[model samples]
Target: MNARRGPAWTNSITSTVRRVLAPLAGSGRGIFGTAALLLLLIASGYIGWAKWGDIIVRRPQYVLTADCIEITPQPPWIHSDIKSAVMRDGSLAELSVLDPDLTKRVVQAFELNPWVAEALSAVKRAGKTAPRVTVQLRYREPVIMVRTRDPRWKGDCFWPVDTEGVFLPPEEFSSTQTKAFLRVEAGNSLPAGAVGTSYGDAGVTGAALVAAALKPVWSSMGLEWIIVRQELPNDVGQPMEPTYILLPAGAPVDAVAARRSGRLVSLADPPADEPSLEVRWGHAPGREAPGEASAAEKVARLHQYVAANGRLDQLPPTTVVDLRPGAAGTAVATGRPAQTR
Candidate 1:
């Protein structure tokens, strides 16, 4: 080495370089071995988790049992069992709390029930021995009753509907229950549909809105029937639509008599001399024709009359009240009491 050295600085630089690389000399195999081991360890871990991940997550604490699912308090009108209805088909069987779609699945399950108008939220309470799911819901409330002439049911029968004209479970209404709500007489054109389904009739939907609006004063006003004119008036045209008339009670309505007698009494037209009053409610709320006052204005006009003359029944018989705008006070006339078929 001494004889081959060209310069002292070059020798010194070579020595320094050799010392720096001394520990790494012959360690290539070791580095390669360590890398291979690390890769093997990583692959094994992945494989192990892949094989047993489901089992680990399926533990008692991670499972969402039927009993653990909770629903928010429901209104008195909701007669159906929400939980039973939602899970009747076992749609959420074996669902896990850690499921990526847990909230979505729970919401979908609740939406299937006719009573649930909307699923507000679905929250999970995890980290417990039994994880829990809490669901917030909005339910449909029966606002009006629809008297249907369906051939399937004998005698007088009525179907309850929500404000949106969505059919409710008719069986939920008892005779006493039926009397508590306003009723609409949609003629033979009333088509049948499943629960939670709309009647698809503009008249029925309109009637529902009117009924809801009248519910506060229904009893005080002595109102009975919401007669949906099957035959649209010949005068019905632009700025004018089919009419909905509010008739005061005590006009010898057969439906009323049938319920009283508990018998199937045939519907017949009332006597020509029967004492009655007719309130011409133009159209559905927010659906007023051109030149017609808003629904609120019409309602205010109606309330004004009732306040002045007491209930509709207290008014003179055959009195006609037009709540439309620009109409004067109630007009007295003579006509047959409209029949509610």
Candidate 2:
């Protein structure tokens, strides 16, 4: 009976120790998990703060100024004009402020340049300390040069004009540059500073149209220049007439006499010693004036005639080509036989 009691006592001691040890182990595991989760959240927040500080809070490296503005692909002659236009407002501070609206204004200033046909954009260059502005410009091309009287100048001088008859400033061109373009005599004049403006003058517009039509075959035709004349009516209440004439580089005396006697009326005071052929292009082409041929039709007819008959010089000296819309709306060439020398 004593031995049985001793075994029961030992069993009771073992059960008490197991119950106490199990609860202590579970509490230790829960505390460790909670501490690890808090540490992970703290590390994530520190990384996010560092990135935000670098992008938004740092000082910018560059500023806007006249020296920072760059215009490209424009000839040296026009550089002064471009610079003058940019600094006209006298506010470098306004340009330096980096903003979308300010960028748009800068682009507009460049576009207003008389020589610039288009201002593509004004944008900031990447990786610059102070942002530099780059401007892309498309310059206007001169199609024809005209000599007109300007009150600002001493006498009549030549100026370049585009296809739309917009006058370009002559101040920037050298004599060699001026002489390279085909000469056109508009027989009209415009006011001072007409560089950025266009004249809707019928004679000027008509001359431009004729020049464009002749461009493709101009070299082959041995043509030198074009003349636009406004003819007065012989009697009252008659509509004025516009005449188009083509002149060779150097015409002989006989050719001049022959042209004077042709079907087309001669200028009362024709430029002395100059000979020319009359195309009888009555009005500006593409204008769709009644009883007139379209520009394309006239060009096509001229091309076909030249292809069949050779250049204009090969034709009789007195020949007058009529490109107007006739009864059948076809071009016709008429003149007396070539005179024997």
Candidate 3:
């Protein structure tokens, strides 16, 4: 076949090697194309190293500051949690929030509030000397855990609570009562460290109203505590009286946060930094076992029933009175079977 083209000497391995290496830096890279490629490679390496430099070298003198969760006494629950300030965003305690080099660190320091979702924190100069770090709080819906169950629950006695559920101590509820949180009837039955909170359903109904905007609704309703009588439509709530607002159980967390925010906005002139309220609905507004009222319909009925009989205050604080059947003109507090869902 034409003498095999003399074994193709033009495409020899030596020639190809020279062609490839020819474009790269040879002995003298002080010139054009090769030098440009070398420079570009160096720049790429430098940029990558700079961006990821923090991973290896850490400095202690600088720190991220003002990244803390706000807690108050009224909720008792809140005060208990915020005993010590912990950094969210993963920043150290003493660092400045505005250090140009620590911008990334500042973004990582905030210990987000359970209700705050889209948190943004920044550092600004305050009157010249000290650095003032300002943080805008974004509240997210609280989530609870289920540690136990009660016969009263439809399935599992879900303790619908806020996000900080696990971090709370049982004693915190001893003073303020955590009943409005998700019901974990079998506290012992719960797996190790498993908590029951209001993360799931509309968070014990009224417990979701932690912000100041909704103070007006609570104020208008004169509701010292709000208890959600979580009920299925066809069964428990339908037969209740017309005066009660029968809200469905398990409202969306986002919706609850929005509603709470809206409610805080409604308060005539709420302070910029108002404390969290001890708000919930089901339990009696007392210290002792005065009987807990789970359902709004049942509570209204119980209220009417007790009004007819004048024994409302005498009911045990933990008892949830189910007055749906014949409570119209009766004052008797009937105990229902305990079924922990």
- TM-scores of the candidates are 0.72, 0.61, 0.34
Better of 2 and 3 by lDDT: 2
The parts of candidate 2 lying over 4 Å away from their true place are 1-94, 123-125, 132-136, 149-156, 188-192, 231-243, 251-275, 313-316, 326-330, 336-341
Candidate 3 Cα lDDT to native: 0.35
Which segments of model 1 are wrong by more than 4 Å?
1-46, 57-61, 150-152, 189-191, 230-240, 252-275, 326-341
Q: All candidates' lDDT scores?
A: 0.69, 0.61, 0.35
Model 1 per-residue lDDT tens digits across residues 124-235: 8863566678999988888877776656778678788888888888888887788778877766435467887897777788888888888778778778777664333344
RMSD of 1: 13.8
10 residues in a row with least lDDT, candidate 1: 258-267
- Judging by lDDT against the true structure, name the best candidate: 1
Q: Write model 2 residue lDDT over 1-341, tens digit each, in one string.
A: 56545444345544554565466457777776566545544654465546553443333443356677777666644534665665674343444434546567777776666777777887777534566777787776666667665678785577777677767777767766765556666554442456767755666656777777777776586565566666556568564546566655454523443343322453343433443454555566665458667777877877776676667766665556667764445567666244421
lDDT (Cα, tens digit) per residue for candidate 3, span 79-163 = 3333233353243464543446553454344333332333465444443334445544443333333344457655433333443
C-alpha lDDT of residue 254 in model 1: 37
Q: Candidate order by lDDT, highest to lowest?
A: 1, 2, 3
